[model samples]
Target: MNAAEVVKSLLVQRFGIPSAHLNAETPLRSLRLDSLALEELRVLLEEQLDIDLEEVSLTPRNTVGQLVAAVDGVAA
Candidate 1:
């Protein structure tokens, strides 16, 4: 799966998020993921995607599409 698909899968499977609530434009905060959860997500993404997230500025204000793009950019 691509970064976006991995992200969406993680959100739904690990976080118990409904698939219906997820979309490219959805804000991170809308998923109710706390700071720790976000951190965990970062680690999970890094491990799963084999990409460094250190340079990526992820915030609650960032949309899912933005995060996916950041990961894809780094992976490429």
Candidate 2:
């Protein structure tokens, strides 16, 4: 799978998010992902994608595109 797939799966499985509404522009806050969730996601990405979260802050204001971009940036 790709970055989006990884993100979507993590949200759905770990946060009980509905797949139907999960779009590239979906807001993290709308999905109820808190700071802890962001930290967990950061850890997951670090282990799975080898991306660091030192710069990427996954907050409710962050868009899916931003998250993808952050991951892409870190992975690069």
Candidate 3:
């Protein structure tokens, strides 16, 4: 799957978010993800995408598309 699809799947499968609420422009905080959950997501993304997100500057305000782009940026 592409980065966006991977992110969406993670949100649905790991965070119990409804697929209908997910979109590239959606802010991650809309899913009610706490800091711990966000950290877990970071780890999962790092593992799944083989990219280190420690320096990616991710935040609750970040959109799904931004997250995907960050992963894509590191992967590239």
Candidate 4:
């Protein structure tokens, strides 16, 4: 899967969000993800995408596009 698909799948799996609402610009804060969930997402990304995000912190305000960008940036 592509980065966008990876991001969407992660959000859906981690937050139990339906695919219909998993837009590229959706704000993570709207889902009310707790700190633990965020950490879980970080681990998920590392394990699935092989991208280590532990050093680069992300926040709720970060959009799916931004997250994908960060991943692409790190991979590059």
Which candidate number would show the highest TM-score if scored against the true structure?
1
Q: Candidate 1, residues 1-76: lDDT per residue as tens digits?
A: 9888999999999999999998989998999887788889999999998888988878888888888899899989
* Candidate 2: worst-modelled 10 consecutive residues by lDDT: 49-58
**Any runs in candidate 4 off by more than 4 Å, and if so which?**
none
lDDT of 3: 0.87
Q: Which residue pairs in candidate 3 have backbone atoms (N, alpha carbon, C) closer than 3 angstroms, thus clashing?
A: none
Clash count of each predicted structure: 0, 0, 0, 0
In model 1, the runs with Cα more than 4 Å from the true position are none
| Ranking of all predicted structures according to lDDT, beginning with the best and ending with the worst | 1, 3, 2, 4
lDDT of each: 0.89, 0.80, 0.87, 0.78
C-alpha TM-scores of all predictions: 0.93, 0.86, 0.90, 0.83
Highest lDDT among the candidates is held by which one? Answer: 1
After superposition, which runs of candidate 3 have C-alpha atoms over 4 Å from their true positions?
none
Which stretch of 10 consecutive residues in model 3 shows the poorest summed lDDT?
Answer: 28-37
Q: What TM-score does candidate 2 get on C-alpha atoms?
A: 0.86
**Clash count, predicted structure 2:** 0
